[model samples]
Target: MNAQIALMLGQDGVTSGAIYALLAISIILVFSVTRILLVPQGEFVTFSALTMAAMQGGRPVRLGVLVLGLALAALVMDVVADRQRYRAWIWPKTSLALVAVGLVVVGLGLSVPFDRLGMLAQIAFTLATVVPLGPLIYRVFFQPIAAAPSLVLLMVAIAVHVALIGGGLLIFGPEGARTEPFSDAVIELGPAMIASQTLWVIGVSALLTIALGLFFEVSLWGKALRAAAFNRLGAELVGISPEFAGRTSMTLAALIGAVSGIVVAPITTIYYDSGFLISLKGFVGAIIGAMSSFSVAALGALLVGQTESFSTFWASTYKEIIVFTLLLPVLLWRSLRQGSVEDDE
Candidate 1:
């Protein structure tokens, strides 16, 4: 590829990777805290994209308005679902949580047939159905096995994936829907051209990341959640409930998904199964971070994005191969180092 073309491609890859990194951090956060892989995390991205597309009607809405609506809808759904499925359960809290989760999956499954609704309405319904469903899953599957092997919780997440995929197929059919980005214009740089939409994606993602980081670092509730994640028993000893932490984390995850979807939706078509693709990519990014630090995950995303962009320009077919090749070496080095440290200890 020409130098100019290579530069442009690299920039594009970096942007894409950054978004994936955000997703990775969100997923890693939940996993590290609860030891439960959150399968529904990608759904949040899909839900946000669909909602933004639905609300804007193929046109770009103001970013502020778009963010506000998506955030509000996601937050509301999360809070309501928590109360209904988890709080209302009478049996062992874990069983109740699972039952609540089942209700959500069933609910989303049913809503797929209502394709006639405008984008806004569909977005609302989807968010409303899924946000609260997390706690229910906790109550049902995780609760019963709370004391069991962490692998069991991981298995529950896999089950969630299976159910969500099946439901998407049943409800939305196999087709995908595309939404136009807010802007179609591109700006020329010295050696690369930047799409306005791409800039928006990068900017919005950065802003949200910064905002969330600040919140977690500075806010009382944020600290509580962190404490809960780090040590549930310790947090509870200080009166911070693990349930509260879990709920908060889920809510944050939902909002992150919404923002990611909004930024990514315009560039690609969204379908019921879009979550699977996103989940895979996000998982890769999260793993690159060793599934711990959010900042590291974000940086990993940037690297991945840059690699993809550059690879697409020079070797489109081998873009993924190239990126993973780089990732493999780094991962191997880290693994060996960790092993050495363990041996020394």
Candidate 2:
């Protein structure tokens, strides 16, 4: 490829890699805290993108109904079950407030004219609609098995992912969507021109990364999560609820996925299930870091994007093959280094 083409490819790859870095961080965070793989993390991406698309198209967004139904069910479940243990927990009460807020947002989304809603408002609506699905999943599905073996939790995560894929098709239909550009300007520097949207992607990723750093290093809740991840039983002994840690981690993962989706939707046609492949790429990047180091995972994700971008030019049909194949050597190296540990379960 020539210089211009290389620059364009680099730009595209870097933008996509930035998004992948967000996903990698999310995967690592959830895994660290909960020991659950959180496979459906990607579905939130599709959910946010398509739901936003539906609202922007002036259609009655169905998420309002869905969220309300889920809220009622969760309430009933809480009422019927050992609410004696859960009734006073702050997270449950906080979740209820968030659901109430989401209901209001979605209600407005369905009623307001699409043109009347500004771009940021639409984004906020989408965020509200999609982010709750995370904690809800943790509460309804994963929390019950929180003490299960890692392998069992992994199975639960896979099952959750499969269910969400089917549900996504039903909710969003098979059609794909692309959002209006967040920016349309291009900056020319010598022969290489960069889209402003790319700059937005990179800038937002940097800001979020820094924010996450601060939150983890400085915030009490962040420290709580870290403590939980390091030693769950110990955290619980210290009055830190594992359920709370898992729920919070899942919520943050959902937030990251939703934002990544919103940023990426404008750049590509996002189908009901588009998140699977994107998340798979992120997972591969996460694995490259041995799922432990944020900086390393970010670097691996950028490399994944760059490799895919260049490989598509060289062998379009085999680009995925090339991209995925990079994981093998990395995995082998990790396995050799870490050896194996048998699960007590």
**Best model number under TM-score:** 2
Q: Which numbered prediction scores highest in lDDT against the true structure?
A: 2
Model 1, position 170, has a per-residue lDDT of: 55
Candidate 2, superposed: residue stretches over 4 Å from native: 84-92, 340-345
TM-scores of the candidates are 0.75, 0.93
lDDT of each: 0.67, 0.84
| Candidate 1 local lDDT, residue 159 | 89
lDDT of 1 by residue, 110-176 (tens): 4444345554555555455445544544544454455456677778778867775675455445666
- Model 2 scores worst on lDDT over the 10 consecutive residues at 86-95
Q: Write the per-residue lDDT of candidate 2 for residues 1-345, one digit (tens) a residue.
A: 788899888988899899888999999999989988878878888888888788777777777666665665655555555557655533456547656865786677678776567798888878888888888788778877888998999999999888888877877789999887798998998998887888888998889989998989999999999999888889999999997899899999999999888887878899987888999898988989878788899899999999999999889999999999999999998889889956657
Taking all chains together, the TM-score of candidate 2 against the true structure is 0.93
| Candidate 2 Cα lDDT to native | 0.84
Window of ten residues with lowest summed lDDT in model 1: 59-68
